[model samples]
Target: MKEMCPNCKSNFAAKDINNINKNSIFIEKQCPSCNKWFCLNKTLTIIKIIGIFLLLITSLLNIFNIKSEYSPVFSSIGLVGILMAIIVTFFGKHETVK
Candidate 1:
């Protein structure tokens, strides 16, 4: 689906949204029509935050050499978080840059 610029209500091509850097949660995008800066909406921002936190926890488990039968579960959770963050980056709503 096309993304609409929150400021001007102009439609953005999916390719444009896909081209954005998904790795940086702090990145802001400028509306092509109005030039107003925007970022992901609060719900998406929170999801991204949680995803990062999960990934961090998983990484720490590896770094500290913590081993358990649930290690796979932790790794899977982290992978899910990363996937969610990436998916939301493209599909999430935009809000005025904070």
Candidate 2:
């Protein structure tokens, strides 16, 4: 599971987990913006997965420049992906180190 830091609110990427111990269930990350360390909650992982999956679809479409009568459907999916990411960023529960 990945999460955002409450201090600077940057997403915790898998690459960021490097050099950190992962023997425990929880994931820890240092915020790139605020330079504070925080732990990722397990619950929001589902939302993160869905959001990234949808975002991949949108990203692929943009890369290929696909457009047609079905363009609106793809556009809507992209919008939904953005919304999901926003929700995960702002609403999903993440532990902020005190």
Distance from true location, Cα of 1 in model 1, Å: 12
User: Candidate 1, overall lDDT?
Assistant: 0.76
Tell me how far the alpha carbon of residue 67 in candidate 2 is from the true structure, in angstroms, after superposition.
7.1
Q: Give lDDT for model 2.
A: 0.67
Q: Report the C-alpha lDDT of model 1 over 1-98, residue by residue, as the tens digit.
A: 57688888898775665324445655667666677777778788889888888888987886676886678888898899888888887778888764
Clashing residue pairs, backbone N/CA/C < 3 A, model 1: none
Please identify model 2 stretches exceeding 4 Å from their true place. Answer: 1-26, 29-38, 65-67, 95-98
Identify the runs in model 1 with alpha carbons over 4 angstroms from their true place.
Answer: 1-3, 12-27
TM-score for predicted model 2 compared with the true structure: 0.49
TM-score of each: 0.67, 0.49
Candidate lDDT (C-alpha), each: 0.76, 0.67
* Residue 83 of model 1, lDDT score: 84
